[model samples]
Each structure stands twice: as C-alpha cells, then as structure tokens.
Target chain A: MSRATILSAILSNQPQTTQLPEDLQFDCPAKAAVTEKFIQMINLIGGRVVEIQRIEDINLYATAHYGAGERLITPIEELDFYTQFAGDEDPHQFENIAFAVFKTHFAVAENGAVWITEDRMGARVLPFICQHLGMLVFEDSIVSNMHEAYQLIGSQDYGFGTFIAGPSKTADIEQSLVLGAHGARSIIIFLLKKEL
Target chain B: MSSIKHPELSDIFNKDEERVNWHDDTLWWIRAKRDKAAHGISEWELLRETASQIKNNVLSNLHNYLIEFEEKAQKNGIKVHWAANAEEHNKIVLSLLQGKGINQMVKSKSMLTEECHLNEYLESNGIDVIDSDLGERIVQLAKEPPSHIVLPCIHKKKEEIGQLFHEHLGTEAGISDPQVLTETARIHLRKTFLTRRSALTGVNFAVAETGEFVVCTNEGNADMGAHLADIHIACMGIEKLIPKKKHLSVFLRLLTRSATGQPITTYSSHFKKPRKGQEMHIVLVDNGRSVQLGREDFRNSLKCIRCGACMNTCPVYRRSGGHSYHNAIAGPIGAILAPNLDMKEYADLPFASTLCGSCTNVCPVKIDIHDQLYKWRQVIVKEGYTSSAKTVAMKVMDFTLSSPTRFKLAGKIGRWTLKHAPFTVNNRLNLWFKNREMPEAPEESFSEWYKRNNSI
Candidate 1:
C-alpha cells in the first residue's frame, strides 16, 4: 500500500538493459576544431563572435550575439554569464538576439544537429532561455534518431537531455508561423572537421 | 441554498441568436486549423491511436504506475503528495506554502486548480495568487470564471479588456489595440514573475518511466515562473500519467495540433529535477475521478486530454456558450464530465448538448463525449431527478400513446383546440414557443387521413 512498496513491485517487472554500441564512441581530440567550426557557423548565420581571455581562471572564451541589430558576447568561462546577458539581474535588459552557440560533447553530422545534455548547460533552461541556441557537434556522435543516439552513451549518467531540431517556433498566435517567440531565435549547426 | 440563476444571460442569448452563430463560426475556424495541422502528418491517426492505448494501459495499471512515478520523482528530489478530493488538494498546497513561510505566488493556467477554486481558497488564507497567463489574468481581474478553458476570455472583446486594463493597470483609456494591451500585460506580469517566491503550473503529461512532467505554454510564462521561483508546485489530475517517453512523442504530436492547430506549443518544458536552489512538488488530485472511473459507460471521459478541440467543434457548445453549463468546465465535454461530479447539482449540464457527435470526431484521444452525454441523461432521468413539470408531461404522453382509443381521442381534441384557440397554445406560458411559431392545425390528423385514403 505504501508508495515505495508499489514502485518496487513495478520496477521488478521492468526489463533492464545495459549494452554499448561499437560505433558509439567519444572523440576528445576534436573538441578544439569543433569549437572553431562552431564559431565559423555562428558568423555565417550573421552572428558576431568575440573572443576573450581570463587571467584569473587561465582559460580562453568566446560569446556570440545576434538579435535585432545588436551583437553581444559573454565569455564561456564565466559563471552566470548567460543570465547576465539575458537580463536576469535587470528587467530592462531584454535583447533581440537569436541564440548563443555553446561547445558540446559531440555533434551528429547526419542531421546537422548538436547534442547538449542538461549536464553541460547546468540546467535545461539555458538552451531554451536564449533566442537562438547553437551547439558544436563533433562529426562522430550524430545518428538518425534518439534511439540510436541513446545506445552510444551507454551507462553514462545524466540528469536530463534533449535533441533540439531547430529554432524556437510556433504558429499558434494567428496561424502565421513565427520562428522565435521566447526561446532561441534560431539554431545554427556547426559541423567541425576531423582535425583541429 | 438555491441562488437565483442568471436567467438574463440566457435570455440575452436567446434574443440575439446571431451571437450564437458568431460564436459557432469562431470555434469552427479553430477546428479547421486543427484539421489542417493534423492532416499534414502521415502518421497522425496511428499516433493518436497509440497515445490512446498507452493512456488506457496506464489507467488500467494506474495504482502501480502512480507508485512508480512517485518513487522516481522523490528520488529526483521532488516531493509528491496525494489528495482524495479538491479540498484536500488545496489544503496540501497551502500547508506546503505555510511550511516555506511564503505568502505570494504566481500561477500559470491550470484547469485542475480552476476546478478546485484554488486561487479563491489561497486568497481566503491571505495569500496573493496572480494569474500569469494573459487570458486567465483577464478573467481573474473581472472576478468571473473562465468561459473557455484554453481561451479564458474568448467571450470578451478587446474593448472590454482595454477598459479593464485601463481601470486596473492605469493604461491610457480608449486604447483597444491588442498588441499594445498584450505588451502592457506582459510587462505587468513580468514584475510578478520576478517577485513571486513560489509558482504553480498544470501538468500536461507525466511520463511514468522517467518521472518527469511536461508543461506546455505559448508565452513561456510557466517556464519563467517555475525557473525563477524558489518553490514550484505542479497540480495534476491523476489521469495525466503515461507509461513511457516514447508515448510522449505520440501525445505531443497530437495535443497541440488538436488543441490549437499548432505544430507544437511554443514552450514544452520538461521538469525532471529540482534545480540547484529550488524545491519541486507535485500534487495528484482525484476529486471525483475515481467514482467516474468506476462507471463503465463514462470511464473513457478520463482519457480526455483537455485539448478543447471537442468544444471548438461542438455546434451546441458555440451556440449555448460555456456559462450555460454553470460548471467549472463547459461545452459538450463538460456536460458529460460535470454530471459525474455531482449528478443532481449539475443535472442541467448533461441535457445541454444536442448529441451531434462532432466532439468525439474532433477529440484527439477519441473520448466518445456525445455518447457519454446521452448516457448521463438516462442515468439522471432514472434517478427521479427530472423536473416535476417534465415528469407530468411525460406521464401524460405515455398514457395517451399506450392506448389507441385515448391517443385517437387526444389527437382529435388537440387539433380542435389548437384550431379554435391559437393564442392560448402559442403564448409566453409555453416557453418552448417563445422563439418559435406554432404550425397551424392540419385539417385532419395523420391517422384520419390514412383511414380515409386506405382500408384501416
């Protein structure tokens, strides 16, 4: 009758599987090249990219901004950088930019999409909070559907994850399709080369 | 305990039948949009069938799956609570807020909350609950219940909303522009979103496998409120659960298309875990669902996704207006479901529909709404709850029809009386004839004509 007792009964009946795919492998060497290609793709989509270095953290960073006619960037290394840009601190700081491109574990070249799990963004809110969000996908991890992609990251723990297709869009207002409403204005897929 | 029902609203509608025509046309336009969006996908029907079956399986195994969902949600640092009824659900939420020492909260549109009158209850307890959705906010300010679930202020014109905003929000008077009025509300609600320490939203779908709840919205208000708040409470009916994530793909594909004819809602935020400094709670409310679920004829009503497609496509709903049902939910779907909550109290609702069957056709989950309404009528009538006048009339008709001699004599008398006294039969005393003209008495009854034409 207790909730725990019922849950145990349900889980006991479930079939559990833990098998890894042969082709599903992470390539750590492509990280830098993927970052560059991501920047190029953002530029190609009419976004401005700015590179900055932090002396205290000893890390390089870049931020891309696109919305209206303004292009602003926040360094990737800084904490709460996106929030500051998104005007969490000030209510008047609403920007007309599309999305922010971030480096991710891997990219699926098959669909020209990027993989950003909840772990990298710290929260699922980040990807949706921006107007347009772009993720750097390494050439190796792209697959046809979610089923194949899940098999690659076998047994890896994550809080949450999602496969975003494109820019935030809706046709609900008046049946006229508007690409951007609250979240990312547009999503640009950056397909990085094999070598950095 | 009988309050005088507002006969004037019904009277006004009766006088201006054109308003019903306009209302029907508006809802039909949205129905057409749904059809267009649904037909574009090749696997649309298959997806609906799968979603329906998945929900059916979950309902059949609900006791087990609910336990699974609660356990996984608790493991993810989300607290879960159960309420046997609406009062209990509101009490649990208030208790949670009292424990947090919070007094103010912002809420996204939740029909479950509306059914429970949670805002009025919370305010009675001295807590300020602000409605963040534009449509809900309009109706909230008016101190009136929402006429439609999806479009809460659908019955009101922009001019009325402009006046309300100007009076309450200090906007320039005489400005009826939607864009300007909407922007004003957006800015006003943005302040509430930032200051409110707690937020409440409705659960569209809860995946039993992952222990996650999905809340869909157009303005992203639900997400904004939840993400910014210290405490996020999601109120869901017990029937919202689905068995797996793959099942969500099927539902998500059909829900928006059926509800508003959109490819997808603007925001479909999945809440799985409580963020770093926030707390999450889910209250599963079962006010009258368990009792309804036990009824074999009406249990399928539980499968409804609250898409409002049924209402949009329902001809009777558009003409009668939602307020006619006098329940938290309205329209054809509401007619069937409301009676199950309180058969005597909501008896009029079930008889409100014309049994056209358009609602079932447009239903994304296929609930057989009109059939259920018809069934409720029979149940109500059998319970001796029919009005005294109607009961007497039915008895007289039964007596006359059961005897051929009595029927023939009654028919001849009726014709003679009608022909002699037209004004008496076609007066205001007969409310049915108020808007209709009575046909002149035939020269002879149909049976009399038949007897003369052929051997009887």
Candidate 2:
C-alpha cells in the first residue's frame, strides 16, 4: 500500500532532526499604537474602520448606511437585528442577508484582521454571504502582529475560524484589483469601546 | 542545444515579443510590491529564517508529524487518506465522491489537485468539477492549465479573457473591465457553490500539533465552498505540514507579503474539524515528494509555501511565461522540482535560468532555487540525458581546453573563421546565433593581447 511504503520511505529518507529555534520575538509596528496601526492597515486593505464610543451606535450606523429595507442580521443580543438565528439555524436561509453584524474575538493590528470563530457567528455563511459585513471588535482586544495573534488563539479549539482582513477581492484579470469577487463587497469594522 | 522541454516551449512563447515584455513587466511590478511589503516589516528576514528552520525540522521529522496529524485529524472527525501517486490520489477522490453519490463538485484553487490532474481524472470518470477561484475559473473555461500558480491566467490578456467570458459566462462581447467581469464570474460561481454537494480545497499549511489546516485566499472561495457544501475534501502535499500551530504566525506573515504585498489574504480560514454536519476528508499525497525528499540537494525545495514570489522575481519565468516550464508547478521552484519527477522529460528546465539568484532571494522559505537549478543541470548531464551531438561537442571543447597549444590554436582558428566568413558561425544551425549577434572579433585573442601589452 502507498501508506506503508510512503511512511517507511519518509522515515528512512529523513536526516537527523534539528532543534527548533528558541522563543522567536518579532518587533511588530503595532506595538506602540494598536488602534492607529489598525486603522492604517484596515485602510490599506480596502476596508473602512469607524470608532464608535457606544456599542449601540453600530445599529444606527448600519441602518443609516444600508437603509431600513436591507436585511440586517446580528447574533449579539445587545445590538438591533432583523433576524435572530438559533444555534442549529440553516446557513442557506441567510443567502439574502444584506448586512451581517458579528462580534470578532480579537483584532490583529498588523494586518487589520478580525478573528471570527464558528461560535461567534450564528450561521457560518452569514458573514460571507452578506452584501456588507460589520465586524464588532473591542478597542482593547487588539494585538500587534501575527505572533501575538497566534499566541492568543493557539490553545483554543473551534470547528472553523477565519481572520478576515477585508472584503473578498481578486486581481486575477490582468492584475486589476476588483473588490467583491465572491464574498462581501464592503467590510466595516466598528471598534466598540464598551465592555462585553 | 538539446531537445529540452522548457526551451522548446519558451521558443514558442517568445514569438510574441510584445506579450512577453508585458508579462515580464507585470510580474516585475508584483515583485516590487513584495519588496515594499517586506520592507514594511522590521523582522522580515528573521521571519523568513524562522520559517525555513521550522520547515527543515518538519522535513527531518515528516513521518512522525504525518502520523500525529492523521491521528488528531481523525479524532476531530476528519477522514485521512494517503496516496502514493497522482493516479491513486485521483482514484481516492473519485471513490469518495462516488461513495457519497456526488456527481458534481465546487473546488477552490488547490495546486495539489492540479498536480494530480484530479479535475481531468474526475471528468473522465463522469464527474463534473467547477473551479471557484476567479483566476482558476478563467483558465478552466479556456481549457488551459494555469500559467501562474497564484494568478492562474496571468499570461492571458484582458481582451482575451473578455472573449473567453463572453463565450462561457455570457458576458457582453468586448467587455474587458475586470470589475464587471469579476462580478459575472462571482454570480456564476455562487450558483455552483450553492448547488454542489461536495467541495475541494488545497491546504496551505497543515499543523501537526492541532491537526488543523489553513487555506488562504483573497476571494474567500475555499471557505464559501466548504461552508456551504455537505462534504469538504482538502488535498495537501506531504510537505505542507508544519510542526505546530504556533509556527503558522511566521509562515502566514511571510506568505501574503511575499506574494502580492498584501498584509494578509482576505480570508485566512482555519479548518480544524468538520462543521456541525459536514463530512471532511484530508488526502495526503506523496506523489514523488518522497523521491524528492530522498534527494539531499533538492529536498530544501519542500519548504516552499507556493507564494509564487520566486516566479514573480524570476526574470526568465516572467518573460518565458509559466507554461514554458510545462509542469503543473512552474518557475524556479518547478525547474528544480520537475526534474525530480522525471529527469529526462525536464532535462532542459534547469538550463532555462540565467542563475541571477533573484528567485533565491525572494523565496519565503529561503529555498536556494538558483543553486538547485545549477545543481540539477549537472545531475541531468551526468545522467547522460543531453543530446548526443551536444555531448560530442562538449567533449571536443573539453579536449581542446585541456591543453594550452590546442586551446590557443582553436581560439585563433575560431576568430579567423568568424572574421573571414562570419556566415560559418552565425548560421541558422548555430543555436547561440539564432537570437543574438556575435561580438566583433579582435585582431588578437585576449591572452595574446595580454602578453604583448605586458611585454611593452
């Protein structure tokens, strides 16, 4: 069988294993100013960021930006929503969601990415299927770089999680940057200063 | 000089000088972007070094990690399969789909599948496969292999893509706007993602510690397909494994920065387990990787992250185009790798380089690409894989160079013939003269000129 042959080949062919490097530390740019760097990175990645003093301000902004007719959905109990889905909710039902407002566990300032796990999202498809996405990240829950970001989530277990930096994009056609290729067209991260 | 694959194919690609220049300039622009991103990070070199070391460790302990990854992944409700070769890999995928009675599948960009020719294999076995990545879909519709790994259709022009889309996706004729065309592909692929019961993705990094895999994409197609589909299959090369989850930080940081100057891909999705009711399968394909591992000099190539940085910075790759390499993977990495798969078939690939070392510098994992290309040439020639005529010519040149009198006489005769009858050396039969002009022959050879000047 290929398995036995492949494993034996790998075992026999491998040279002496070397020790991994000790405690690799990186001096990321966001170490000094997390929010400032996060804003700069988010803009660089073609995503907008809004600083909201109050958590409730997001609903008003979403409604004002998307208007009242758009199908806005949020799993956060405190915020306003048009649809609330259960744990066992079908992801296909949210195919027409216009706005998906979800809470991100943490934000990486170096890349402007917000960590969204399956538990944070009511339906896994909501954030991706929605026309626009609003990622709610706490002001203090930001790391300097990927090193710190991975450090925080290394031990955590989840079925699925993604560090979404911006809305879906592609430069496949002659290297022309095109936004909204297959996922949310616009991504706006709201930095909530309130306690969860 | 010899009947090599890359040179023959590149000769055809070089026919369109304008397109070749455009392709070169386009990839160079990306290379510049990578430089900008790399300079932005203070610890860029450190990150590269750490990633390279981690990969070295993984390679030296690959068997243990694979076993560990399989055990943990199985515990996480993911079925793991091992395939020795491409045919076995394709058959395993086919059987999985057949077992589930799945007739159609939506797949994201998985170069492993491309390496295995999985799409063609499945199609021949009566299964329909749809490529969801915009670039992959463009090449798929054109019935062409991906020229570039990251940018599948980079060799194609916007107008050509417009025509392809107009015929396949019903886009309006002569509409070359990327924004409009991308939306059209999005709509077309969205329907496929929703309808297809099974989805396949290529694994970017498989963590042995946690038994999770990461798939990075700017379009989020992998996540969209996997999340929506009932079944998800992740095909990964044995070299994709990392020692631990913590190692991902160094790799993830280097991957997008070196690729397209992006801080991170739009979606860096981590799949640790199957979703609530979804069935996930992981296919680990050796498929010549073990043979490559056996090669001491070329084994460092297994550290590649497939970021395409090497290709972007490669002057020959940019001008000759990816298809010229004629491997599923192309460019500097492919040139070193293709020979391991079949030395005789890819004998000319290593010679397709200028050995400028730009690819070696740009590689995220620090693979000594140019050095390997140089080494592979020696290995290929030593194996007597070159044309017999070239071998005889090389032998004659070697014989003349071994003696001072013969070398001087040969040089004197060569310059004399070139000066007296330029057509004798600058004819169609001479490969060097085919695309170049012979330098003006001096009155005296360089050594003779040096001796005369010193005596004065």
lDDT of 1 at B355: 88
Residues A120-178, model 1: lDDT tens digits: 65444556555556555544444432234445544344554444544544332223244
Could you list the chain B TM-scores for each candidate? 0.95, 0.98
DockQ of candidate 1 compared with the true complex = 0.11
What local lDDT does model 2 show for residue B369?
96
Off by over 4 Å in 1: A1-117, A120-124, A127-196, B1-9, B12-19
lDDT of 2 by residue, B98-153 (tens): 99999999999999999889999999999999999999999999999999899999
Candidate 2, DockQ score (0 to 1): 0.82
**What are the Cα lDDT values of the candidates?**
0.68, 0.90
Which ten-residue region of model 1 chain B has the weakest summed lDDT? B1-10
Error of 2 at A6 (Å): 1.2
Q: Which is the leading candidate under TM-score? A: 2
Residue B313 in candidate 1 has what lDDT?
A: 83
lDDT score, residue B14, model 1? 55
lDDT of 1 by residue, B1-456 (tens): 121122334566556667677667777888998998788665567666666666667656776668788888888889998887788889998998999999999998899999999999999998999998777888898888888888787776677888999999999999877766766776687678768889999999897777888888766668767876889999999889987655655676688789877555655566788776788999988787766666878878888888899888876677767776677788877878887888777766766677888888878887888889889878887886666666789899999999999999998888887899888888988876877988888999888889899984
TM-score of 2: 0.97
